[model samples]
Target: MILYIKYMVSLRCKMMVEQELKNIGLHYVVVELGSVEILEDITLEQREALKRNLLKSGLELLDDKRSILIEKIKNVIVEMIHYQDELPKTNYSDYIAEKLGYDYTYISNIFSEVKGINIQQFIIHHKIEKVKELLLYGDLNLTEISYKLHYSSVAHLSNQFKKVTGLTPTFYKKLRRKRDDNLENI
Candidate 1:
């Protein structure tokens, strides 16, 4: 039996879900970001118990089709940004549409209506977050970050980063370093 879960975006959320499943005496064959496949059919009682347990952790056992599709879209984007080393070579709209098996326009409209953000804006938000992570870790230069994130140029990445955060990537990195240094003195 396959179950869709909402708000299961992070690795911690996955672990919480796995623990909840074990506590409920269910064994899962697969436990990915947004969905789980149980080894055996679950009972109504088990479902209710699982739902209640997941709710306590701010996760929902999804049933609505539109909600499930929305979660799937979010899961796809999250997995691409955080888990994958590289993004799809194709344009994001094509990649998302192909993965979801839906028209890009339809998906975009639905996501905007539900989340109040366009898909492009959503992708930019996540990409900027990834940039911050790389900067914090001091692993990649601006040019490399631009290339890894598929930006047109370092200037473009800088402009977008500044616009989103009101701080240049370089300044952000320095600020984080300063804060870490101050903490070390304590």
Candidate 2:
């Protein structure tokens, strides 16, 4: 049996889900970012119990098809932006469509409807967050960070960073503060 989960966004989240499955006496064949596959079938009662337990830990058991698709989209974006070391050369729309095996138009429309923001905005938000992280680490200059993030130029990166964050990249980096949003909330 396969189970989709919402808000299972981090390695710690994966561990928590695995622990919960064990606590519930369920044998899972695999547990990934936002879903799990169990060895045996689960009854509705077991599903409900699992849902409650997961809720206690700030996770959600997804049952609806649309919601499951949304979660899959979130997982793909999160993995691409935060977990992967490098961004792909291709456009994000094409990458997401190919990865999810869905039409780009369909995915875009659904994402906008459900998320109240377009996928482009989501990508930009994540990119800015990534910039903040790199800045905080203090390991790279603006030019280096722009190159690493595939930005066209340092000027462009600085402009966008200031537009979204209301501060120049240099000033923002100097603050040495963390400003990030929850993946689930994104």
Candidate 3:
């Protein structure tokens, strides 16, 4: 049996789902970001109990096919943007379509309809967030960050960063450092 879960994006979420499965005496084959496979089929009663337990921990079990597909799309992008060590070599639309085994047009339409933003916009948002994280870490320079994130150039990165955040990358880094220093002083 396979179960799709919403809001199961982080490692912590995977752990919580695994623990819940154990508590319910269910043996799971694998627990990925947004879905799990169980060794044995589950019962209706078990499903309801599991749903309630997951809800208590801010997760929801997805039953609708459309909702499941949406979650899968989100999980794939989140994993790529936030967790992967290197960006994909191919373009994002092709990557997403190939990964999800659907037509790019269909996926884009569904994602836009459900998320109220185009898939490309969603990817840009996640990429910017990742850039913010790397900048705050202070280990990577703007050039290195751009290269790693597959940007064409540092100028491009700076432009997108400014466009999305209304502040340049250097300014954002300085602001984060200032906030950290203030917290340490207190």
Top candidate by lDDT: 3
Q: With candidate 1 superimposed using the best TM-score fit, by how many Å does residue 140's alpha carbon deviate from the native?
A: 0.8
Candidates 1 and 2, the one with greater TM-score: 1
User: How are the candidates ranked when ordered by TM-score, highest leading?
Assistant: 3, 1, 2
Q: What stretches of model 2 exceed 4 Å from their correct place?
A: 177-186
Worst 10 residues of 3 by lDDT: 132-141
Enumerate residue pairs that collide in model 1.
none
* Residues 63-155, model 3: lDDT tens digits: 999899999999999999999999899999999999999999998999899989999898998999999999987599999999999999999
Report the Cα lDDT for residue 129, model 3. 96
Please, what are the lDDT tens digits per residue for candidate 2 over residues 67-101? Answer: 99999988888899889988888989999999999
- For each of the candidates, the C-alpha root-mean-square deviation to the true structure, in angstroms, is 1.2, 5.6, 1.0
Cα RMSD for predicted model 1: 1.2
* Stretch of 10 with least lDDT, candidate 2: 175-184
> What tens digits encode model 1's per-residue C-alpha lDDT throughout 1-186?
889999999999999999999998999999999999999999999999999999999999998989999999998998888789998899999999999999999999999999999989989999999999988885789999999999999999999999999999999999999999999999
Q: How many clashing pairs does model 1 include?
A: 0
**Each candidate: how many clashes?**
0, 0, 0
Instruction: Estimate TM-scores for all models.
Output: 0.95, 0.90, 0.96
Compare the candidates by TM-score and give the number of the best one: 3
